[model samples]
Target: MRHFRISFLVTFILMAVSGWWGYSHGGMPGLINALWITGVLGVMEVSLSFDNAVVNASVLRHWNEFWQKLFLTVGILVAVFGMRLLFPLVIVSVATGLGLVDVWTMATTTPDVYAKHLTDNHAQVAAFGGAFLLLVFLNFLFDDEKELHWLGWAEEKVNALGTESLAVLITMGAVAACVAMGPVEEKYSVLASGIVGIAVYIGVNWISGLLEEGEPDLQDDEEEGAAPAKNGNGDLVKTVARGSIGGFLYLEVLDASFSFDGVIGAFAITNDVVIIMLGLAIGAMFVRSMTVFLVHKGTLDEFVYLEHGAHYAIGILALIMLASVKYHIPEWFTGLSGVAFILVSLWSSLRYRKRHAAQA
Candidate 1:
């Protein structure tokens, strides 16, 4: 109870301070929308990211208290500011003639134009994001540890590049060329980008395996009181092997991935870049903090199927991304689906506890 209280108060203080700062810098309308936008987006993000904490908990069990704190403080910065702050601006600036600062101004001042631009590109954005997420969701269907033999045909095609660096560079060139040819076709860009994302995932996994196989094992540190660290040829595998970063990184990566859609989507909601940033930043921060709380408190362990629920939420988000490109789904539906999932996961946990208590 004491730990829970401390975590809750700490989160409240941080949110309050950030909210006040955003309001002061932005105008009253900006402030008002920021509050509403932040509330809605925050709840949505946190609910969707519950699986992130569950995965983080599994990996975090290896870390000492210091690393845990680092994961909270530094990791949050990486997730919030790096992903939510910098990435969207980078995407918009590169995609559109607008700089992030200008986008911010437009979001606050000339929201309609900003929105129009985003709407213009929504389909391409949706296709790219939708396809990428589709691959991600499909990955869980296969045995994650399986080698790429099943994808042998794809492997041969990808390997024809001779080197991973070349493959990535070639992919980038292709995307750039498509963007440059004016009147960017939504179908083409979406398909290419989607395939590229899947290729990158597979390529990286393959490369990591080869590298790990060549390494020598590290001496066990009895002091650590954790599993033996994997040392390859005296090089410590400092990170988890084979997609082991857990739901946190998945959520973080997907959150950033989702940002392209979100920032693009936000333009439609309101142009006030200040409102967009404040709303989204607050939302991102809250989600990150919520992930931390879930990990620290063992909420997922308490709720056995919560992780599965979050994955389902991701699937929904992916579908929304694809659907938004063409048809309009009510925002209420997007927001409510996530909320409902979280509530159900929570209910499952409570029920489990009650049943266990009665049996005991």
Candidate 2:
């Protein structure tokens, strides 16, 4: 309850704003409709992003207090305003050769046209986001040093072949396949965007690695009464105090990737830019709060396979995004797939705990 206090507050404020906006446009009926849509959109965003929160917790658990607070405060601002509002406007501006103000006017005054312009460029967006997310999934899958395996047979084989190069190769192959099979006109854009995504992932990681080079390794500092560090699999492991900038940048980019699809999908529900932003903003707030809750509660440590499930969901989502570049995959399917993985992994974790307890 305490962890979610802020989220609930934000929800109320946003809903009120949404209701007022609706009333101004269409009186009582409009207000009712606006509130309904806003609530639905908020739920949609939350459903689509639950895995994002879990993955965020996995990385955020390692950060110190200052960075965590920054994530909740500054990071939420970026996720809400940056991604939800400005990002769509920016895309429209670039795609249509309009100024920011012009794009904003178009979005507010003639939302359908704004949505069309944005949707028309969906292929490039999908390619870049899908490629980046694919790399994220592959990196997690190919971690050779990973101790626990959720699906041992498959994971062990892949982990044995773990190499950064292999992950890149697979990602490149996926992009190439999409390019070759996609619309002839879209091939170039998809290919170029895919490469850019790969480069962005590599560049961000390289910079993060460089920044972390001199940090004190916390792995060897295990002392009496000191809490042991835990991996995503909930296994005790060596840890390090990482440079905050790299982690911060990594998380921001990750949030952007996760949001690309949601922003685009929001059009299907409503073309009202104000509603879209407010609804998604509410969802983003909850995600940040959920991440904080997970970190404070040590939920990841307890759930064990939750991270694995999230990464697996990410992989599925990446594939779906890439596939959607050429096909019209429904957004509901994407959201439900992730939730399914989390639930199954959660059940598995409970069973594992029970078995271990019996053995003890």
Q: Write the residue-wise lDDT of candidate 2 on 1-360 in tens digits.
A: 899999999999999999999999999999999999999888999999999999899989988776788899999999999988888789889989999999999999999999999998888888898999999999999987788789978888888888999999999999998788789988999899999999999998887787677554555555445575455533211122353577777788889988878998889999999999999999899999999899999998898899999999999999998888889999999999999999999998898889888999
Q: Which ten residues in a row have the lowest lDDT in candidate 1?
A: 141-150
State the TM-score for model 1.
Answer: 0.65
Query: Which candidate ranks first by TM-score, i.e. highest?
Result: 2
TM-score for each model: 0.65, 0.92
**What is the C-alpha lDDT profile of model 1 across 261-345, one tens digit per residue?**
5565565555555555555655555555555566667776677656545545555766676666557876567656756765676
Q: lDDT at 104 for candidate 1?
A: 62
- Clashes within 3 Å, all models in order: 11, 0
- Name the runs in model 2 displaced over 4 angstroms: 216-243
Q: At residue 131, what lDDT does model 2 achieve?
A: 94
lDDT of each: 0.56, 0.88
